[model samples]
Target: MEEDSTGPDAEVGAGAGRGDDQSMRGLVEALARRGELVDIDRPVDPRFELGGVLALLDRGPAVRFTDVKGSALPVVGNVLTDRERIAAALGVPKSGILDALSAAIASRQPTEEVTVAPCQELRFPAADVWREVVTPTFFEKDSGGYITAGMIVAHDPVTGHRNASYARIKPLEETTGFVGIAPNHHLSALARSAATAGRGLPVAVTLGSHPAIQLAACFYLGLGDDELEHAGHLLGEPVRVVRATTSDVLVPADAEVVIEGVLRVDRPVHEGLVSEYHGMYEDYGDGCTLEVTAVTRRADASVQVILPGLAAEHSFLGALPIAAGLRHALRGFGCRATDLAVTLSGGGRVDVVVALPPEQRKQAKRAILGCFAAVSMIKQVTVVDSDVDVWDAEHVQWARTSRMRWERDLVLVPAVPCDRNVPMQQDGTVTKVGMDATAKPGDRAAGNELAVPPRETMDRVHGWLTSDGLGGKVRPTPVVRGALHGAHEDGR
Candidate 1:
């Protein structure tokens, strides 16, 4: 017997997720090692049960369903569900995410081209194995199975610039499906250009690469920009790429699966109900059809599924990249913000919180305006002191309530063109609001003091804080009689 060599276990061995926490498998392995990944060995259905499990664990660690009922490959979900997890994959601290992302965009490196792509080791007819591989229908209202995590890669027909972005793909037929692309997305522009020249756009959907690649794809860069190069900077190494079977477009060499296809922009189809960031279904009339040419995958690869619809993974994917851009834009506006977060409450699309020094409170207006200008999806902004954590909703709300005066601090800018998916959008425009929550100048702000318990006393009472002790009822402290007598004698 001989072991067929493919390059590493290709993520099948016992040590699969042990090494660098960069690739999807490796990150899951790392999470498992850190007790951040939960495993369900029992047989589970991918249709709704799998999504149910992921939704239950949405606020927790990553999950691996070892036996998906109808699929040959296992399914992994919620891999990048939290900021700390994302930071861990990038090998950076939570506070440094914006800096790391900004550097990656500005200092991009080229990808490494490889002859043998792990994703193409095994090839199957597109029409034959749509279900053999994993495709989960997350919600009941959804029309059918959707590939939410896949990054669609296509080069511009005019400039030859490669573009990668995340689009929802609902497989309608064995070889054809609807690709949900907003009119403003770069892929739509690319597809339109190809249609103008009387042809379908060539595209290859890359799935299960390094998490950085996914993050890179979410970025809203200029039309001529290439995110693959930026991913190299984020990964601290060049992303491995290989040519697709049906097209010249290059995809991640290490991706678990690659669905090669041609997008027909001219022939549009109903995309069914798409789960928006707002946890609601969005029916965008119709979208372009994707005619899959070939489907390739790793022999023992685990199909990666990012649970969509208000899940943490969904929010992080949409929020992190744009927040990084907003941070850079604010810097250019002379606002030295230390932290920025696109809140999950706003579906990671419309709400954001920024933190800066108290002295820079006056610049809150500029920061707010900067956010609205940078990302059209963002409709609400809150600026807080650097000491307040932007990631915590309660802290942000407290800052707004404590420091902001309703009449003076509320700022609204009207008639802004934003994401059509926004619920309040009327006639392609929406009003944006910003709150100056940073400390205000005056005697009221200056005289206020924050009370905190002594550190040593709190430490001493950690185990003793109970209903009978310090928790249930407030008890008065008694002064030592001996000390009081001594003080009285000396004073008299």
Candidate 2:
């Protein structure tokens, strides 16, 4: 008998994610090796069913849907939903991602140009075929299907600085879509610059590449900054690229699919409803219309989809990178920011939790202000002592409950520049708040620190629990034990 060779798994072996870890396909194979991947053979509808499965299975293994109702292409999701997975891709531990990200940004490298690339292996010139391809309507309220994982690659026409970013693309027709570009994002700035010269901005939407690049693209940097170079720092090597067929903009040479197009300044499309990363539907109003001129892909390329909303993929993609960038900027500005976290509750955009040395607690307000200015989208900041774990929501809340004094520690700023997608923002501005949750200097000598059992005693207790079949796992409570016993007795 012959081995199976009929689906996405066949095209991309378990070794796919094990490749360079610098391309999308490489990350997929890497996930497979880690037992973090699930391949589905059942045919799925692109409208909502695909996104449904992705949302329902958030934080689980990455998924690959081999069959779509009308398209030959397959779709994959949740490749970089977890911080651990992202950390692994960047060759670092979860605790070190912020430092790794900062170093990568500081050590930018130019991409190597290749004469031939896999993305251009197959080309579709017919505009009508694009709509037939698989795309996702991630939510019920979504006006139409969208490409949530596509990375936009463009260059400043004047300075020639390359930029990569993730944007929401709503398909209006086979070859045209309305892209929601926020005012403060670098991509929006480039578009505005092009519009000033009465010209359309050429762009390449590269989908299904490495998570390192995806994370890099989410960074908020200045006009002359090149995100692709920063991606190289994460990858530890220069990324390879090829010029798009329709645009001179270079895209990932190994990307599964590339949509070569132009963002028309004169053609504005009014999208009635679209899902924002905050897991809510917002009327983006008028957006620049994108004209897809060419669709290029590998022979068996996979279309990547990021389910919008509070989904892990959407949340972490925005949260982790933004937190790292803010931490980097704060430290650069002389703030003693030791660690930081962007809360999932904040939709990975508005709320940030930071940790600093106890002695530097006085500079908490300065750190908060620097973060807000560094990342305009940040609306709330919480500062905690170095011992506090920012990644743990409970720990952060505990600090807030115990250390905060409303009148003295709460800082609020009004009418700051913010992401347009924020529902609370009126006319692209919103009120921001910061909380100093770090223990006050006076509390240090008053026994304000948390109390825990001696290390040796705790270790003995942990050993006993493990002996009782709770090895390396959170101990099951009485209720869980009762339920398990009941199920066992019933022969379930």
Candidate 3:
């Protein structure tokens, strides 16, 4: 249930899992050794070319842009595109990701601070440095360049507890950028407090961190929760942090790049049209502004970039933590959430699939409401029996079609708080829908049995796939999605 976090210098032996690498560079090298890295030597432009390649190569290998047309620093994209990749990053099987993340969040570990850090190897003044160093525009949107994968670190003004989360940073002036901080996000709330005191919020933007730490930053914890501690637990060791040069906020010791800045409460900047995780452009108007004070990086630092809307990286990153948080919350609410998944089709934020027990069918509405309350971003909830595979979209859809009675099983909540950008939503309110996709306890005999292949046959097919070098090219079908046979009685 717990593992030691190995320092950056620790060597992970051959056949080690992704968890063995706790630094960005370490994961990069590991991926390279496993032939999962795509090294691009050709010089690419940062404005649209680098992002274009990433978009074109979505769901493909992790890309390393070895050459940038204008800057000396390289860029990497699609660090973890799909759920399988996310699972590998967390050092767990795909089926165990939700439990692993939930458990990690519950058992927090203390973070260890170090004196020297590789991230500070090269230091530069903030003035006019961002335009040259930070990544350029990812998409051809109306706005300028943005940092899509930066993990912002901020501390609670009253508690001093640190929190790390991902937000799109829109670089405007040479030393200033506008950050899209939703009103519900903890960072936004902290910024509000700092504003009332007539002071700026000290923050550090870390790019290119370990996969575990990167994923940990996405967890939807309480306001004062220390995400770094949860990240340590996920890593099986304490996260090593270094005091920033220009601020008290400590950044990951092995981060590829760190930008120290003060988020100004008095200076709010309007963000032009920008792409969001929903695969669409929306103008969030007048978000928080940050004045960069310092920028530091490794001598050969490689900037991390996530192509917004095009790849599953953005959706998958948000989905896992949301599901994990919801699972934790539902369990606390007395619901047996065997598994949870946030579907990509829902843009990774709006829809969720939860698997529970047949006997708990009556409580499905409670579970649905519990999830919506736990994760504010979720707009639709689907509850299925424990036998369902929430990760398989087809299986979930099948369950919805076969088990859900639209008139009886659908629960609709009107005028609920929702994202402002949702279509046709003017007052930030939307109709939330919950579907109970579980078979009736007494009608179990009326359901059809799933027709699945024999284990021996599937195993042989998998072996053949590996032998033919198509192991990565194809995935074994989700057996649970097999066609239904004649009606059969089964125990609930």
Q: What is the TM-score of each candidate against the true structure?
A: 0.87, 0.88, 0.89
Would you list the C-alpha lDDT of every candidate in the order shown?
0.78, 0.77, 0.76
Query: Compared with the true structure, what per-residue lDDT tens digits does model 3 show for residues 97-202?
Result: 7778888878888888999988889898998457446566777664888888899998655557578998888777778888888778888878777777778888
Which residue ranges in model 2 land beyond 4 Å of their true spot?
Answer: 1-21, 126-132, 156-158, 444-446, 455-471, 474-492
| Candidate that beats the other on TM-score, 1 or 2, i.e. the better one | 2
Candidate 1, residues 1-492: lDDT per residue as tens digits? 011122222232211224343348777777787687888999897789999999999999889888889788888888888877777666665556788887776777887788887888899887855764577888989888888888999975555878889888887776887889989888999999888888888898877888888898888788868899888887777777899888888888888888898998899897767778889887788999999989888887778888887999999988899888888788899998777889998877789999876568789999999998888888899998765667778767777777788898899999988878886788889999999987766729365333444435543554366524654342322112212221222342
lDDT of 1 at 422: 84
- Look at candidate 3 and tell me the lDDT of residue 362: 77
Residue 340's C-alpha lDDT in candidate 3? 82
Candidate 1 has what TM-score? 0.87
How does candidate 2 fare on TM-score?
0.88
The list of candidate 1 runs beyond 4 A from truth reads 1-22, 443-449, 453-492
